[model samples]
Target: MIETIVFDIGETITRDDRYWASWADWLGVPRHTLSALVGAVVAQGLDNAEAIRLVRPGIDVASEYRAREAAGRGEQLDESDLYDDVRPALTALRKAGVRVVVAGNQTARMGDLMRDLDLPADVVLTSGEWGVAKPQPEFFARVLEVAQAAPEATLYVGDHPANDIFPAKAAGLRTAHIRRGPWGHLWADDPEVVAAADWRVESLTQLARIVSA
Candidate 1:
């Protein structure tokens, strides 16, 4: 039985299309360009930092959008909406005795985004706050400790294979791949990642089904 469900915010719980579209517009590149680049970065098995490093020199990282995010003054664009049914679905899960935790690579400052969306998770975890990035066993371990869940009893759902699936599996948590949000289509070659996941859910609703059932 899955006693807890830990979520990643950006591309997992929230749709990142607006943010990426804004980023693409600011960078003067096509939206798919951002998608393709991120796909390649993840496929290369680079962690978030290394992938950002590799992509930075190729693009202007100090542009207005990223500048705002860096300064902690960035306001989310339209891409920050919760999945259409995610909140109510999660609410149902909470009612069903599953604890929910938010784990992501954001900053505590990102609490603003969650607040704005009126989504209050039971507990929030971020790489910025934890000083660790995903695909690292310690990251998931920290979340597990906070949720008081055994690794096998927790289900981690996120969009990135390396960040979400890899480390969660490494840490002994069941994993779910959110297959409808940003960077969703990039995990094509190594289908095994999603294939091996406990659930390959196309939307949050599907995930709720897996969790609540």
Candidate 2:
């Protein structure tokens, strides 16, 4: 039985509309342009942040992030950013005695913002806090450490195939490929993703039921 369920933040628990839109405004480019570029990079298996670099070559993204914060426009997260199934599904899992954790590739500030939202998770962590990002063996090692459970007893859920499904599976956790965002939809039917994911779900509600059973 699965004792712990770890989630990816972007496109898994939350919609990334505001994130890309904010970057578009900051870069003075049309939102659709950046969105298209993000999708392009995601398809090509490049980092999504490459979209920003495409617009401004040699730009220091971290510096720009600080600049945006200094100008009073940084990362923002609230109720609307969450998927409709997030609260109910996570709450249900926790109530059912399943350990729920939210760990994703996000900044330290984003982790604080996530905590402020008070989602029903036992732990909320970000890559920025752990100093390691996904697809890395160290990141999954940290997750297993926090979980305090055998890898086979934990499940990792996310929308990205390369970052979420593949590595998590390699770490011995059962993997669920959630279909929602650009990468989710684009790679949902890919042979590798389908083969790697132990479960393929469209929504967290479906995931909740799968776990409960």
Candidate 3:
């Protein structure tokens, strides 16, 4: 009888690996280094947006990659090229009477990111706009209010452990962890992963079934 769903946008709904490849190119650093940095920061309890802000200012990591792409010399890239079935999946969930809301730590270009990808989101909550990021119960609180959903009736799905799992559980919402590759070892290993979630799946399509069930 789940009536609402909260989703983390980047990896859970859309493909984020290609975006990270772009970020690695733009920053002029190896993708592994960026992955390590992000993992370390999140391991220390910083959300994704703050971690990027903290690291980007001090180092010129991949900053030039975007300019090269704009000049048509870098890797073939476009947000449009990376879309999945998330939009249609969400539309179906809404038609089935589930309220869908998106929450993330989109830092500077939240609007541009969504526009560039044509992602379908009912409501977008970003750390840059909210001054708070995920893993904090308050972030989930705000989204629940916006979606007019009771915590007992809601479920949250995301890719990260700390940001998505712990807080949503603390807020009394069921959680689904989407397991994918390309993230560094900064994440918890198997035990934590197994312990933190109510359900775990490999893709949002599986999540569609969970909600309907």
Candidate 4:
């Protein structure tokens, strides 16, 4: 039985529209331009942040991030950012005796924002807090450590195949490929994704049923 279910943040639980829109505004570009650039880099298997570098060559993204915070326009999150199914699905899982965890490639501030939302998760963690991001064996190792469960009994759910499905599966955790984000939709039909994912779900509600079965 799947005793624990771990989730990715962007697109899997929350839509990233506001996040990207804020970046585009800060960079003084039209929202659609940055959105297109993000999709282009993602399609080319490059990091999404590459879009910023593409817009302004040789710019230090970290420094700009700090600048934005100093300007009072840093990362922001609220219940509005969450997907419609997030609360119901996570609550269902927890009530069903499953441990629901929210861990993702997000900033430490994002972690704080997520916890403030009061989602029905047993734990909320982020790459910034952990000092390790996904697709890294060490990150998944931390996940297993926090789960305190056998790898086979823990399910890792995310939208990215490369970062979430492949690596989590390699770490011996059951992987669920959620088809909602840019990466998710792009790779959903790929043969490799199909092979790596133990389950493919369009919504978290489906995941509730999956674990129940």
Highest-scoring model, TM-score: 4
TM-score, cand. 1 vs. native: 0.78
TM-score of predicted structure 2: 0.98
In model 4, pairs of residues that clash are: none
- Candidate 4, residue 157: the lDDT equals 96
Give model 3's TM-score versus the native structure: 0.72
Candidate with the larger TM-score of 1 and 4:
4
lDDT of 4 by residue, 1-213 (tens): 899999999999999999999999999999999999999999999999999999899999999999999999999998889999999999999999999999999999999999999999999999999999998999999998888789999999999988899999999999999989799999999999999999999989888788889
C-alpha lDDT values of all predictions: 0.71, 0.94, 0.68, 0.94
lDDT digits (tens) for residues 142-207 of candidate 1: 888877888888998888877788778888889988776535566733567757688877776565
Model 3 clashing residue pairs (backbone): 26-62, 26-63, 26-65, 27-61, 27-62, 27-63, 28-62
Candidate numbers sorted by lDDT from highest down: 4, 2, 1, 3
lDDT of 3 at 84: 66
- Candidate 3 scores a C-alpha RMSD against the true structure in Å of 5.0
Alpha-carbon RMSD to native, per candidate: 3.6, 0.9, 5.0, 0.6
Among all windows of ten consecutive residues in candidate 4, which has the lowest summed lDDT?
203-212
Give per-residue lDDT, candidate 4, residue 15: 95
Q: What is the C-alpha lDDT profile of model 3 across 23-98, one tens digit per residue? A: 6666667887777776666667565444455546764334554466577655433455443667777778887888
- Per-model TM-score on C-alpha atoms: 0.78, 0.98, 0.72, 0.99
